[model samples]
Target: MVVQRLQAAALLLGPLIFALSPFFWVDGHYGITGGTLIALSMVPWVYGLIGEYERLRERVPTLAGLWLLLLVIGMFGSIAFGLQGFFEGVFDITERVSLAALDEYPPHSLFLLWLPGPSFPLALLAFGVLLGWTRMAPRWVAVLVCLAAVAFPLARVLRTDWVAYIADLLMVLAFGLLAWRAWHRPVAAATSD
Candidate 1:
């Protein structure tokens, strides 16, 4: 029970940190750092989710590991991009080392504009689909998460900032539903194995 509570807190904290990052970290490097932290926070929740579904684990042992792999890749990619900002801040070399082609873009917007940005959401989509296939939760929960996943990549394709916010909101909704389910799930169900 205590483990579940901690897992729930980790699940909630990932999004909370991400949502508040824009405000708390104005420096672009710090923002990316926040993203890295957000990614780190998600690990325990993922582990808990996998653990909660013991039957699923017995049937498909590799799925949860795959999800963790993707999450780590996405987070590390974020950190890699953030390194540019770190270099800029630490060495004061802020003349746009290699981003000259994006002269018209905002200073740090480029980080979220491509590559790693789309990968994270796509990974989530895959994970959500797998979770749904396992039928460990209501189908609608998976559907909502899938919808949220779509929003992120769509936002990238559209090249608009507001769309990402909508995606974030959708993710929050999906995660909120998961949290509710986790909280209400019977102890016997969790301990059945």
Candidate 2:
């Protein structure tokens, strides 16, 4: 019961945190606010993993576990990036930083931070696929999640925000609905009576 509530909270909170990112800070590299929120959002994502375990059990335990592990790796990456931003901000390093150095090095250039950017979506897409396979969610939902994840990179490459924005919105809605269903799902009576 406690976990369910936390899961619901996390579902609601994660997107809210992302929404706050833009207003709180501008530069992704030098700003800690966004990355920190991304890191903190992991709590609910774990709740999501827990829900998967309860739903799939041994049938797809491996997939559920994999999702959890990868998502966690992504979370840790977000934390590392956030910490890097914090250090940069504290030391006032952004100004002294060179464009050439930034182009070459960049913030979160390390595997941890970079990998998570994609890993997080991959994990979600995997989980969504599994859910679709189990008929837990509509296949369209899973498809949309996958499409959205895929669109992110394309959006970046194409230099368009619409794809990313639409994809993000879809994910937010899908997760929100899933969370709602999970949290509101009724428990069976102990006895049929």
Candidate 3:
């Protein structure tokens, strides 16, 4: 259970941790430390989320699993969009950055920081309403998570960079709640009888 929460936290933290990379970039090399941790943290997130979603499918029987894949896609799209700078080394992201200040940032990848944060939450909204709120997912929790997506992101958007910082904090809370619910649920034996 702790492992599951850590994995969920890793998924959310991967991007937030990246935001803090500036402080650790020593001598032009973020080093194996930052690079490795960032890279390694993703594995468990993918495995854990996919595993949990699959289990949810067994218990619930819906296309929620595929929608989770949609979340993964938007995540990668945001990552790729943000990394428009790194893309410049091999291809041309100049058009992508047009007038952005990061056009000249070295190792030239800082532009990846620009990935859109609100998209995944929005995507989850549709999936949750269609699949979970009606019958499968814990109804109240599903509703709250979706609402948190809108409220937190909207609050941030109205204020600019506030969205990124506050969104990270809120996401930590959301994942923590998932962990709590998953952990505290009655054991299967209690239900099977």
What TM-score goes with each of the models? 0.66, 0.73, 0.52
Candidate number with the higher TM-score (1 or 2): 2
- Tens digit of lDDT per residue, candidate 1, span 1-36? 665655556555555555443332333333445444
The deviation in Å at residue 24 for candidate 3 is: 11
| Top lDDT model | 2
Q: Tens-digit lDDT track for model 3 on 29-123?
A: 22334334333434443444563464566655556666676667545544443343234433433443543655566444342444333445565
Better of 1 and 3 by lDDT: 1
Expressed as tens digits, the lDDT of each residue in 45-90 for candidate 2 is 5666566566766577777677678877766665665565566666
- Residue 156, candidate 3: how far off, in angstroms? 7.4
Worst 10 residues of 1 by lDDT: 21-30
Off by over 4 Å in 2: 27-30, 95-111, 151-165, 188-193
TM-score of 3: 0.52
Cα lDDT over the full model 1: 0.58
Highest TM-score model number? 2
